[model samples]
Target: MILSTTPTLEGKPIQQYMGIVTAETIIGANVIKDIFAGLRDFFGGRSGTYERVLQEAKDYAMQELMEKARLAGANAVVGVDLDFETIGANGSMLMVIASGTAVRI
Candidate 1:
């Protein structure tokens, strides 16, 4: 499936609007990793663990959104939006959301 933040695809015209499709994922942070991240924060460097976790969450959410579009018989999604939220103490929880208009080309 093709997913984009733009309103229209490059070559094909959107044939049908299959309503809105959205997918979200909530993840709990690893305490062990958090401890290391705290230390890394003091050193003022990148946190590989945090990056990997967020990336995984985004991928999972996007995949789920794509699956929803597929179920709706859409070949693509347009005006895609990505959102992130951090919840709980020590940023222990993360939420990733993907939203778009499902369409058939």
Candidate 2:
């Protein structure tokens, strides 16, 4: 299935609007990883642990969004939007949400 951040896909006319689809993912820092990430922050380089977590969360959210779109019988997802938020105690957790309009082209 095709997914686009724009409202429409070029050269692909929308045949039907299948309503909206959305998915969210939340991940928290583990104890050991948190300690290492803290050290990386102090040392002034990118935190690989955090990056991995973000990537995993994003992938999971996207997967879920696609599944929802498929269940909606959509050929594509348009006007895709992504949101990121920090939650949990001391903002120790990460949340990612994906939303879009499921459509048939």
Candidate 3:
């Protein structure tokens, strides 16, 4: 399914609005990853471990978002919004949420 951040898809007219679809995912930080990330932070460099985990979380959230749209009988999702948040003490978990209007275009 086509997912776009814009309200309208280029050259594609929306035929119907199937209501809003939303999904969220929360991934906990792994101990090994946190250890490596802490070392990287102390050394003042990027943390690949954290970055990879966040990326995976985002992908999973988007996948869920698309599944919601499909279940709503939408061929596409428009005006998509993605949000990120850190949860738990010391930001031990990452939350990714996706929302959009499910549509047939």
Candidate 4:
């Protein structure tokens, strides 16, 4: 299904609104990754481990969002929005949320 951050898709007119659909994913930080990230923070460099984890989480959330839209009888999702936040005690977990308007075009 097509996913767009804009309210409308170019050339394809929306035929029906299937209401809002959302997906959420929560990932816990690995201890080894946290240690490496801490070292990277102190040394001033990027943390590949954390980056990969975040990317994976985002991909999972987006996939779930697409599934939800499909279940809602939508061929596309418009006005897509993604949010990321740290959750859990001591911010040990990362939360990713994907939301959009399900539509048939």
What TM-score would each prediction reach against the true structure? 0.96, 0.97, 0.96, 0.98
- Rank by TM-score, highest first: 4, 2, 3, 1
**Predicted structure with the largest TM-score when compared to the true one:** 4
By TM-score, the better pick of 2 and 4 is 4
Question: What is the full ranking by lDDT, best candidate first?
Answer: 4, 3, 2, 1
Candidate 1 lDDT, 1-105, residue by residue in tens: 999999999989988999899999998888898888999999999999999999999999999999999999999999999999998886689999999999999
Question: What's the CA error at residue 42 for candidate 2, in Å?
Answer: 0.8
Using lDDT, give the best candidate's number: 4
Predictions in order: lDDT: 0.95, 0.95, 0.95, 0.97
What digit string (tens of lDDT, one per residue) describes model 2 on residues 1-105? 999999999999999999999999999988998899999989899999899999999999999999999999998999999999999998889999999999999
Off-target runs (Cα >4 Å) in candidate 2 are none
Deviation (Å) of 43 in candidate 2: 0.8
